[model samples]
Target: MPPIPIDNEGDPRLAAYTSIREKDLTSGHGARFIIEGKVTLETAVRRGRFALESIFIADSRIEPLAELLARVPADVPVYTAPQSVMDKVTGFPMHRGVLACGLKGEIPDPAAFLESGVSAASTLLLLSDLSNHDNIGACFRNAAAFGASAVLMDAQCCDPLYRKAIRVSSGSTLWLPYAQGGTGLDMVNAAKAAGYEVWAMTPRTDAASLTSLPVPARLAILLGAEGPGLPDEVIAACRAVRIPMSEGFDSVNVATAGAITLSHVFTAAV
Candidate 1:
């Protein structure tokens, strides 16, 4: 099966990639979202192993894409054109010659999510008000690397399936299970109801230190985005917890903090 080759900017096959030009990532006729650039492309394909629909490149990079060219399915479309056209359509000079789109999806319910983990698994990153795709994606990558069983984002958070998040996660977003539409409050209740101890990551004076908390058999670490921090009600909903930090700096980036917390939890208990 030879690859589907498309060269024209106006080609209908390029529809998904095209609307990105108009900044319409999607309007709901069902199109795979795209992540553009080399790092993201490599991550999306190899690490996340996302269900990629196709790859697009410019005429100038037939040789550059060689490493992945052979691996791409023969039936997947690969589009190329003069640098001028790709640049005009994409709104910038191309760097990767590799733009790929992937399917949108949701993971199963959290109970099923918990059941999928190894019996000895230890930690989960529970995200509440994470709105930035960059932060959410990085959190997933951090969770994956630090041995968190899974990453969970509240419905108020951005879709982990969004292109920016998928790329920021270095495709770890795809590798991890994600759910949508549930809120921070719902996550806390669910965590408690499921028998997993919930630790709301907050900097309040009385919060227990991450390393000092009685490590539980199953744990969910709740995180809020920076600036606003956790809502008072959300923080009050769980046993409060905080990461140890240097003097005068009582905080870490939510993603970095998640990594640190997960590292501690993973080694301490199931």
Candidate 2:
């Protein structure tokens, strides 16, 4: 189908793309979430699990992105607007000049999702109470980059499908099989029941150094938010491991720590 032309910022068809920053801060994108940039939009088209509702791009991008746009299913609407209108509509500069909206789809039962999505020897990342969108995005990127089979997040995590999170992830959240819901302990127990060797990532002195810990055939690394880290009971429920850091520095950014640990697991698995 030919691209639909959008001339005005108030075009009702572009309603989903308007005031993006405000929507992200408030009630959120609801059943639909926005995708940003060429690379992330490409990821959404090729590898994303969710269905694309429609695509909105700057008019100037039409020719440059022609080949990529050809890959989009013809049935999905593609809207093109002037760069000025695009910026006004989205409440941002519209630098990359591309966006898409995607359906959230039905969230599966967390336990069933793990049981069906993972193998007996799978590597997994379990997240708990991570409120930062960037950290959530980075975790998905790390999980995908390091060959983790799936990611499981507890009830308190920020939405990985949030616009900024999706962009920060470079769209990994679109492809990586992940389930978000349930309590932290519920996540741990689900992984344990699935026969995974659950490891709580913490900086506590009693935790074993990651370099010394053996990677199990089936491993789940659980990470919590930055400040409080994992709860004491949660840490006690599993094998505890810490990345060795220099004297007087026991911690790293949670996402950075996740990347380091996932790298260790990926290295061992290979």
Candidate 3:
């Protein structure tokens, strides 16, 4: 389909793209979420997870993205506007000049997804109360890199579908299968019941060193927010493991820790 011209930012068809920053800060993108950047957009299209509501791109990007835009279903409208209009519509400077609105489907039940969505020799990443989009995205990227089966997050965790999170993950969030909601303990219990050994990552000196423990065939690495870390009760519910550091240092960034632990599991499982 040919690109449709969007001469004005206030056009009703551009409603989803308008005031993006304000909307993201308040009610979020609602039933649909925004996808930004060429790479992330490409990943979203290739994954075919979310339904494409529409795509909005700067007129300058049409030729460059011609091949990619062609792959989009004809039913999905592609809107092209000048850089200034795009910036006004999105409430930000149009840098990458590519954006898409992806419609979310019904969220999967966390327990059922854990029990049946994954099978033998699977590794899952469990996140609790992680607020930073960058950290969440990095963890997803690491999980995908190490071939983890899926990611599960508690109610307190930030949305992995957040635009920044998706961008930071280099679009890993677009492809990764994840379920959100439920408590940390709820996740741990479900994983345990599903035959996964839940390992809570912590900084406690007394916790078993990660290097000292053998990686399990079916493992779930549980992590928490940066400063407060995992709740005491949540940690107590699982086998606690700590990554070794120098004499004084006891911890690393949550995402770094995730990469380290996931690499161990991936290497051992393979």
Quick one: ranking by lDDT, best first?
2, 3, 1
lDDT minimum window of 10 residues, candidate 1: 112-121
The better candidate by TM-score, 1 or 3, is: 3
Q: Show how many residue pairs clash in every candidate, following the order shown.
A: 3, 0, 0
The per-residue C-alpha lDDT of model 3 at residue 26 equals 19
Mind giving the per-residue lDDT tens digits that candidate 2 earns over 1-270? 889998999999998899888885223343888998999999988888899999999999999999989999989999999999999999989899999988887665458787785444378899999999999999999999999878899879988989889988889999888887888988899889888899999999888999998788889999999999999889888999989999999999999999999999889878
- lDDT by candidate, in order shown: 0.72, 0.89, 0.87
Q: Model 2, residue 94: what's the lDDT?
A: 88
For residues 1-270, what per-residue lDDT tens digits would candidate 3 score against the true structure? 799998988899999888887776213344788898999999988785778899999999999998998899999999999999999999989798999998876656468777675535478999999999999999999999999878999878888878899999989888788887788889899889888899999999889999899887788999999999999999999999999889989889999999999998888877
Regions more than 4 Å wrong, model 3: 25-30, 116-121
Model 1: which residue pairs collide?
155-181, 155-182, 217-270
TM-score (C-alpha, index-matched) for candidate 1 = 0.85
Clashes of 2: 0
Q: Is candidate 1 or candidate 2 better by TM-score?
A: 2
**Candidate order (TM-score):** 3, 2, 1
